[model samples]
Target: MPLKIYNSLTRQKEKFIPINPPYVGMYVCGPTVSGESHLGHARPYITFDVVLRYLTYLGYKVRYVRNITDAGHFEEEGREAEDKISKKALLEKVEPMELVHKYTNLFHWAMKQFNTLDPNIEPTATGHIVEQINMIEKIIEAGFAYVVNGSVYFDVKKYAATHNYGELSGRVLDDLLETTRALEGQDEKRNKADFALWKSAPQQHIMRWKSPWGEGFPGWHIECSAMATKYLGARFDIHGGGMDLLFPHHESEIAQSFICNHVQPAKYWMHNNMITINGKKMGKSYNNVIKLTEMFSGIHPLLTQAFSPMTIRFFILQTHYRSTLDFSSEALVAAEKGLKRLWEGYENLKKIKEENFDLPDDNDLDKKINSLLDELDEFMNDDFNTAKVLANLFEIVPVINSIKDGIIEKNVLSSKTLHRMKDALTVYLENILGLQSLSQNNETFDGVMQLLVDIRKEAKSKKDFFTSDKIRNQLAELGIEMKDEKDGNISWNAV
Candidate 1:
């Protein structure tokens, strides 16, 4: 079956047909770079990362673009016109660019920990000022924008008279006009619903640039439309971000693109749901946000233990992208244990080999195994239902473990079928899912562990009960388990 995607624009599932065959372009909104990335930021990056991987796996040359908002976007849009970066920098007593550099590096490090692929082009809002100016000029020339007192505002009421102003957001123009909140620049706007394309910079503003209107910066919404159009052309294949951006941010992008390019910006609009805690959305305002650094270091007051990066990724993938993933220490612990089990099963499957003895095929068992492997692709095609795909894999874990424990004969299935099952499990777990073993994999670490094990064995042989017990206790406290086998062999696993 052809891939099906749930388009937020049409509010339904539609067959994915790229405008240009075998070549797809995707644009996702990136971080604002004013602060460290938190748990909430992981969903879209991981979600779209899987999407990019799956498309490439299906033989498509994809160009993915994610932009960084390092300029002009204000805190509390339509109100103070204060740049988020500038405000944070002032409080931290540093240059705006210096702060951007610091947090952008942090964001990059966090994405790396999550194993997300880097975008083909990571355009910054500040880097494309000329492009933003050019696009705003086109909008003004097209009679959709008006300049007043050195600030340009999109004429929402005027544009609404001719086109569907709130089509992407499903907001009625009349309702928007009636409920428009008063902002700092409301006196200059003809209508309250009109959003700023360019805000006139006050003398104290530091991130000002020379635009057609005056020395000001591009508004929050215009930066994305300008950057995406510049890199992905007038129209692209898919536009993705968090569900929180479905309004004012993405809605304004649609309006700006229509005015400048005479068409919608992208064919498919996809959004991932938010991460919540205790049924409330996790944000800085609510004091519920767990920064990625805090999560990895277990420095936050709320975290029970430091979660491994792979465990966090697996936790997020356990829930559907469109569903809210509630956060808790218990849930994370469960995910950690579950992931260990899954990985153990995968490792066992990799070690299985075909036996030379030929026996009648167990058609029922073979069909069950084959069906589960084939359904992995089907579940992914259905709007990237990763949770379902994982569920199917979990069902195969016992079968693999059974084979490993000699509960099932290896010759019950053909060699080709066994090999195929191993390949399928590897592809979905490693390639498409982008998961890796979180345990240390270096030679130094391994050698140190072996040295410790050898010392403990020698201590036991010498009847030094105190030394051997001390070694075992210390290793257990450090999250390593040592097992004594019936043959006097010692094996270890990092808990």
Candidate 2:
């Protein structure tokens, strides 16, 4: 099946056709390294990670770029942004650059825990100040931006007159002008619709740099447009971010490119819906956010218990990208149970004996399984419907378990078919969907555990009740658990 992606600009799913066949370039808006990433932050990165993974699966050489916003953007007008990093430094009593580095490393750590693919290039707004300046110059040269009090602002009216400024987002230009808050920025910009390109730095601001526009910093939206174009060229295959950015942030990016290069920057625009808590946005202002580390450690007030990053990944994948995923402890618990059973069944399938897959083959179960696997490409191709694909996978857990229990057939499948299915399941679960089992104890630990279990079983068989119970009770004190299976064989797992 051909890959299809829902284009945020077009507001419809379209066949994915790369600008250059066999090669694709994608850019995603990454975190601003001002603070620790939160649960709300995981959606877009995971959304695009699977996009990158599946494109690679489809045999596309994909170069994925996601930026880190280290250069602080304007939080309000007339006042310098308490520089995102500098302000963080002040609060934490550290240097601004140190704060930036700290959070950047933290974000990377969180991404690593999530099993997200590292982008081909992680351009930083601070590092690409020159590219941002150049892009601002081009916009100025093209008469779509003007300087005011040392600050540069995009001329929204002119750009909108020439190009469809609201193409990427459905926001009407007039509505923006009408509804724009009459704030301090109203005086600096020519119109309410205009946005910052390069924000002039005030004396109070310390993160200033010498630019063509005097000592100033690039605007929030300008950083992405500049860096994406610099690394991925003026036009790329896919650009993605959270839906919150679809309006002013991503909309301005399109306007900037149209004004300077006379074209949209990306062929595909994808937006993931927000992760909400109690039907409200999970944000700092909302005060309901679960910090990524908090979620990982189960230290957040909102989380009922701790959840592994893999369980979180599975929970996210069970929902469509464009749908609001309500934050719930119950939902995560369900996902954990589902993943545990699914993964355990899949693991056991590896050791199952295959005398003859005839019974299942006679029922055309292999064909049915293949048919489901075939639809994975179709589901993923349709704007990366991870939810549907995951649901399809969950539907087969019973079949896998039945095979492991010797209740289903595997003999009919040739080695190639069996291997293909296994690979598909692993790739989708681990690589694309980014799900992994909780890290298990090391081999040495497992060996000791097995030895303990063997000794306990031997004691039980010989009716050495005191010794067997003592070993079991001692291990339980150390948080080890044991379960005796139906066959009287003892199985132990670490808690």
Best-performing candidate as measured by TM-score: 1
Candidate 2: where is the Cα deviation over 4 Å? 76-81, 353-362, 409-417, 463-481, 485-490
Q: What would the per-residue lDDT of candidate 1 be over residues 198-237, giving only the tens digit for each residue? A: 9899887889999878899887699889989999999999
Which prediction has the highest lDDT against the true structure? Answer: 1
Ten contiguous residues minimizing lDDT sum, candidate 1: 354-363
Candidate 1 local lDDT, residue 191: 93
Question: Alpha carbon lDDT of residue 473, candidate 1?
Answer: 89
- The alpha-carbon lDDT assigned to residue 257 of candidate 2 equals 81
- Which residue pairs collide, candidate 1? none
For model 2, give the 10-residue run with minimal summed lDDT. Answer: 354-363
The global Cα lDDT (0 to 1) of model 2 is 0.83
